[model samples]
Target: MIRTLTEKEIEISGEKKIYGTLARPASAYTDEKFPAVLMISGSGPLDRNGNGPKGKYQLNVYKELAEYITKLGFITFRYDKRGTGKSEGDWISTGMWDLVDDAELAFKFLQNHPQVDRDKIIVAGHSEGTIIGTALSERQELNGLMLLSGGVGNLHEFTTYQRMLTYQELKNSKGIKGLLMRLLINEEKAETKTQKQTKKIIESNKDVYKILFFFKQPAKWIREHFAYNPRVGLKKVTYPVIAIHGDKDGLVDPSLLEELSSLVKGPSETHIIKDMEHGFRFQYEQKSMVNVKKMLKVLPSRPLNPDSLGVIESWLTKYFKADVSSDIKENA
Candidate 1:
């Protein structure tokens, strides 16, 4: 039976009131103090169950995984990011550091719980959450980490891939595709606009020149992300890590994740799901609603193949057994 948990809230770095849920398994009360996982959702104003204004699959992916993992004998804690769901804060104004700290609050909460093993705390971060959580694994006294569909390339490269995909969409329908291409591709000014700003042109009346010109100066948000690199920071982590990426990701560069696995020369395992996308969908179509649905869908270890939640489930299982690895290896 899925036991409902007492809700909790905390003030994040920017004073955002973030809310969370603790899914207490029935076995936890009887078993050896269980290994607890802190679930961190990706970007945007996501809720504890993976629902958000951003996009489809609203089945509470993280919560579903928690149920499955809890049955496999683990405890789970998940939460809403600042400025979304029951939480109160401004999403657009936040930075990477702010989110990392916000997620850690849940771990700290679990640490103090009587049911949790003081030494066994796992952080399972999906998408953007992976970026924040992996960076944090270095600092916190975590037992292990699970990074899913994480973005790892430098901001500039990732944004370029995003821009091309976005422009390709606009070109698909707009008869003025040639003209727009010229405005964006050859122009030096277009280099500065964030992908979000460039996308707004589809709905806004702003001229292409103005959009491209804004890129000439640089955006504050871009500056915030450019200086914050997940791969570089994650290198400091000494904890055992389990990371996986879908083969068909639309938002983040698949190479970004592979790069992270390559760079984290310590205890890390990387899995590339053949058909999955950024949201873990087997065959994903990138759209506002599609993204919403994908985010809500449970990433069953491996897309289409539930047998191998990759090394994540097994890694947590072993770590809790006290055989945590200090040597890293990548699995295909």
Candidate 2:
């Protein structure tokens, strides 16, 4: 039988007042506790529902994950990072450590909750969140850790790879203009160009230049994130870890799953979802600019990769012993 699940708006105080959703199985006259999972989003200005900026896209990925896990008899919590969604704080000014601190606060809040089985808390992080989750596992004692489409190599190298791929896509679509621009701002030769020379060339297209340089590339958070290597922290975690990556993930390399699994001293397992993309969506043609544009326009209607959730459920059931036989439903 499917049981009821209840979700409540929760506030966690940190450097600022952080807002989140706490979900649990609803039971009629019992003070029973259950295992809990904390969900952390990837990167950028994503809201609690995993929706990016208005015109970008709305995936609702994290929210779906929370609801799905809650149905499996585990209380789940997910929050908006500082400066995004309902949370209070400045988003752009926050660095890597700031995010880690916020996650730690959320973990403590879940651990202390009366309806949570403190010993059975699991930290599930996606993309950039995987780094934070792995780092937290090293510092805290936890029952399990889950990494979804997370990176395991050097941040700088990964950033470069992503940059090149994007540039290549643009070149393929924009033809000569894109090729010329990319050649001029070659990341490999970025160090050789003086500030004045770089500024002069970028001034020709200030909008794109600012986005690539000031906003996305050279920001404080980017620098700090670039310095972090998940492998370093994964080496210290002694708890069971499940790392899942999509075979078609464009942002992170699939090989990271092997690197991550090899570092974990505890029992570790890796899964590669065939034809799944970075956000656990059906694999879309990223190489073609026309396909990319069409996919972005219809993203809200796109269904998630069905296999993704099943994999997570089965892994949790086998490793974390999360009860999947329950049928409780709770309203938020």
Candidate 3:
């Protein structure tokens, strides 16, 4: 029988009031508690639904995952970033440490929830969330961890890698826009500019940096992320861990999945799904940062890659059994 799902608004108190949503199956035993997954979103100003500022990024990744996991009988909690949605604080000024604090509070909230199985709670972090989750695991004990679209590298290393790839894309462009880009951009010069900007962001004490006196960049966030290494915390994880990445992902290197698997001391597995992008959508064209951004324009109309979901489901069931049916153990 298909299970019915339920959802409700949840508020978590941190430096400011953090707004979120909790999802679970409707049917339950009198004394039964369900395994839970506390979702941490990737970098930037995102909400519980995994959307970005001004509805520009309407990628409903977390919302889709919550419903999918709830059907398998696990309660999931996802919250808005401080300063975005209904949460308190200014997102532009919120640093990486600030996000980690909010995630820690979310974890504690799950631990005390009446219907949640405290011992079976898992953290499912996506992209930047992977960094926050790994750091949190080093400080607290969790049943398992699911790292999605994240690597075992510092923000600086990843950004450098991304810049190289985006430059390659610009070099291989075939259209008039590509011609203009090729003529206007010098990779060597761009790298120099990037290095200078990185140095400025690292040295500056300001929360935000204004470029051309109009565009604002999160200085604190960049500095903190550049300084923290996800691998350091991954080394301390003794619980079951699963890392997933899309081979077609343009934002993050998929090879990082191997490094993630090797760093964790406990039982772990890694999977790289084909045709899946960073946003969890299947990409039909060549995967590039430019194409990824273009695809985001229609993210709402796309479906989450089934292959990626299958990998996650298989891994979750293999180690942490959920309330799937009478035959499966509720907590394993």
lDDT: worst 10-residue window of model 2: 200-209
Q: What is the TM-score of each candidate against the true structure?
A: 0.71, 0.83, 0.93
Q: Write the per-residue lDDT of candidate 2 for residues 245-294, one digit (tens) a residue.
A: 87767677666577765787888878888777777877755433225445
Q: Report the lDDT tens digits of candidate 3 across residue range 128-242.
A: 8888998888777888999888858767777787888998888778889788878988889999998897788779999998777888999999999988988888898888998
Any runs in candidate 1 off by more than 4 Å, and if so which?
1-14, 28-32, 54-59, 154-156, 167-222, 284-311, 321-332
Question: In model 1, what is the error at residue 70, expressed in angstroms?
Answer: 1.8
Model 3: pairs clashing at backbone N, Cα or C within 3 Å:
none
lDDT score for candidate 2 against the true structure: 0.74
For every candidate in turn, the CA RMSD to the true structure comes to: 8.3, 5.3, 2.8
| Cα shift from native, residue 159, model 2 (Å) | 1.2
Tens-place lDDT per residue, model 1, 32-122, is 4666888888766678887766654354667666666665556677777777777776665566677777776667778887768878888
Q: What lDDT score is found at residue 79 in candidate 1?
A: 76
Which candidate has the top score in TM-score? 3
- Candidate 2 Cα misplacement greater than 4 A, ranges: 1-3, 54-56, 167-187, 190-218, 284-294, 323-332
Candidate 1: RMSD to truth: 8.3
